[model samples]
Target chain A: MSTATQTMPSVERVVTPGKYTFGRIMPEALKYFIVITLAISYAFPLYWMISSALKDDPQVYRIPPVLVPNPAHWENFINAWKSDNFTLYTFNSVFRYAVPYTLFTLLSSSVVAYGFSRIRWPGRDKLFYLCIGTMLIPYTVTMVPLFIIFKHLRWVGTYLPMIVPALFGNAFFIFMLRQFFMTLPEELSEAARIDGASELGIFFRIILPLAKPALAVVALFAFMGTWNDYLGPLIYINKYTMYPLALGIQKLRAMMSQVGNAPLAYPYLMAVSTIAAAPIIIIFFFAQRTFIEGIALTGLKG
Target chain B: MAVATAKKWRLSKRETQNLITGLLFVSPWLLGFLLWTLYPLISSAYYSFTRYDLVRPPIWIGLDNFREIFTDDPRFWTVVYNTFYYVGISVPLGVVVAFLMASLLNTKLVLRSTFRAIFYIPSIVPAVCSAMVWLFIYNNQYGVINNLLRAAGQPIIPFLSSVEWAKPSLIVISLWAQGTAVVIFLAALQDVPRSLYEAATVDGANALHRFWHITIPMCSPIILYNLVMSLIGAFQTFLMPYLLTNGGPMASTEFYAMNLYRQAFEFFRMGKACALAWIMAIVVAILTAILFRTSGRWVFYGGGER
Candidate 1:
């Protein structure tokens, strides 16, 4: 049924010459041209970011920017790493956000999403709708009040303000995961149920293993959100030592700019940015298929 | 009343257990909503009516904040107008570009996946990093864009620095980094039944006509989704203008969010900032409601109930 409809567009277009046959060559050529141009345009900035990190401060603003450096300066990365205090900041970031939220959000949200998806719970639809409706209330509306609430709890400047939100389970993530869970055959869970497994046991043993793809999506998104998040850390984190990489990087810029003629060493900043992002980039490269598929499935719900 | 009481008592024990279990299952969300979501929402509304600045207790201000926003504050209306202008232009332009790219890539053409990936690649670049790169590109002196323009015998234009061009410059950057929307569109396009197009073709419709008449209508739901979200996103835009213009060059790109951020954080006007956020949220909610009402006329859902 699908193939018959897909083949019609093939009939009308004219054929061409040699390797570029009219029937096929044009589409292929057009595809290649568009693909190559787009790939370069997309990747070029990232390439420049890395290149700028290596180039000396003097060469940073060279007219008609050089694409490649002659002798690569590896020290720029080392300098950036040291100056930005990325080691401490990255650790703080991981401890403050990645570690806490990963354990918290995944365990809590997945369980919730599973229950919502699989259970024949009364008022489930109403509850789910209520949660989803919160997505309409802009994050800005929540920010100030959340700040005040955290302050009253003496959680401001502590990681709790940032980390504790995970306990609630994000609405959008739950919905996305629930949708994916709904698509799974109920028989598997039913079979498990009949085998004398408790609901908790089934969730831990059978359902979780089957839901790795969705879990990975959730984890990747959570990690990225926490990592690149500037505003949250800016508002909550006060002590310099408590600062995450996002806040730390901004401080680095401010400090560097303040000290006049200190090489304006942005290569280091660039290097830090690259390093900060390296883990996600490496993971993204490896799991491009699953990640893109997940994005498509989730519809950028966050 | 006696019968009702008897009926309530007559409910099955197993059914009552299930109800308790269901509440247990949803307890996390329920508790969080009350503690975190509901409390904050109410507190924010209260804060909007006060003159709280974090250090001091909130003073009852009645409708002063709203009144000030409407009349006394010179730039409040301007910022709102600027925000709407940005949303008005950028959302449609973004949808059209994304749609065009999605269509072009959604073919039996060779290396289709590779093409799609290329288009979807820009979104991975950190927002700040992408903004910085565009800043360089929009540089009037020796920028690649202006250089190219010169080569084409066009006049050199001040892209980001110019007040008239700043928002548009940001829009251009937005289009470049629209990998998310592009991917979504492609996915929606993939779901579009090819049989509709084949039927249209058999009826002697040309490719362009079929695309306009069939491809577009079929994908209107996705378009509506993107449009509403993009409008919301664009209005709440910060970081770019904050980093690039610093809301400078006479506050040309002084967006509502940026203005709110300045008021709250910079000047420590927490109450006013809360008011601004509330107003913005209300505006967005209304706009979204309008979009939802209009969507039924244009949006064609494939699977869901009418």
Candidate 2:
């Protein structure tokens, strides 16, 4: 087992098959063609989203649909922003919800995972397994009762219901970080302890620094989960002012109908969707290695 | 002497200190489980046997909600059918598509990461955002799908609005996010020992035969993993239908979760909703158990242990 910081490139290089023949070349070309086609199809919707966001109302309805925006309507973004209280929604998403949620989830889950993986104690494995077992219990089973509990605490309308839970640690994240924590050599912690370092000191000085990649993965997942959470906000926060980008975007189309806006709202709505999706897409590009590695590790170990 | 030994075994001082430290570190999750998960789970079960709305205290009414769900509620059956329809079609199709894409990407190619990222971007997109985008794409008039159809001289199909098209439309939306599965399968495919394929090739086995015999079996464990995961996900389908169509003009796409949500919130039927939730949990558990049981026949671990 290696430190979490060690990068394992996912691509495996296979030995090239003997000689290239026309028979092989034809199939190889065909394989590339199919792969390209699948890639194009997968990317097409995202392309349409951006292009449609740029097209003006009339151009959007052109008989032969425009593959690209001829004159990109950057103003559509302005209109989309003005169409709803998206500024408020964006603030709620970033400052009020995602930032705090990600921070708490990453910090707390790491601490819990360290306890489970690094420290030896009676019933440690059993307690960790108990935590893992809860993952199989679908959230739907608990949604109604939890809603009632929050309501009784009068936390429903506030961000507390969504934000407070993250401090408790997520089971899946605990499992992931614990797995990564276990991979680091135990001798480092042992050496730290022999030097008269406390458990907290060892965790903070040695284990935490070594587990940056895994911590980053956990943080990324927490950010994404909080950013895209629909049902949580939908259930707990009833006021329009508390809506995150996900629920806010869901309400945009209906709000248009209530305002008796023309059907040309499609382009503007597309602009809003593009705005909502851009942060995640940009983050993906920047953190491509972390994102791919996280997915691969979870798949392998899950 | 035996009594003294038993007393000594109870808690050595060092063991007591270790236990205290462990408990202190894990207290956050422990407290959370006690208050949030365990309490809610037990209460939900208790509430399922009672008649309660939001305002009134729950009144004991054992099996009534279950009886109504099984026999009286027509919408319950409709939701069951719709869920099964979505799960049956989407899970297998998603697995095949993911496996195929993974296989294609496993070959030597240029900019493999770029291709992988392109496929994966959709899965990371916020579900509500993707639903909104697809709603526009599936718009009957002045939408991409309709425009393409008109150009091909085909009739414009009402995708989100029409009962016939809504469920299938939702399924198509789900396929857009199968990139997670593709990445998983690609990792699994790469783990398949290349020497096995070479040995088969030396034995004059063609590419198809090698793939059929070696690739599929080696990846079967992951296939089962993906299958069970997708099955559970499909059963809990909510956001797409909720955002795209709001369960549609005729409840055509009213998935089980959507119906459960509506019952709990919209209709204020808390007890019945709890019952529905319990039933969904049971179905998921049973399906997962069945998959695990049958996995012994097909799913092959690398070490030859069933």
The numbered model that scores best in lDDT is 2
In order, what is each prediction's RMSD in angstroms?
Answer: 4.5, 2.8
Candidate 1: misplaced stretches above 4 Å? Answer: A1-35, A194-196, A260-264, A300-302, B1-11, B135-157, B303-306
Compared with the true structure, the alpha-carbon lDDT of candidate 2 equals: 0.86
Q: Write the per-residue lDDT of candidate 1 for residues A1-302, one digit (tens) a residue.
A: 12211211322222223564585666567766876776687667667667767778546655445568656788888877777567888899898787888778887788888778777755778888888887767778887788888888999888898778788788867887787677678998899878988777877898889888888888887877777777787788899999987777767766766886357346665666667656766777787776667766645232
lDDT of 1 at A224: 74
Error of 1 at B1 (Å): 26
- The digit string of per-residue lDDT tens for model 2 on A17-67 reads 688888878987998889888888889888888889898877887887888
Error of 2 at A7 (Å): 7.3
lDDT of 1 by residue, B194-259 (tens): 677777767888767987887888778778878877888888888778766878667888998899
TM-score of chain B of each: 0.90, 0.92
Candidate 2 structure quality by residue, lDDT tens digits, B206-249: 87897899899998989998998888888888988988888876
Docking class of 1: acceptable
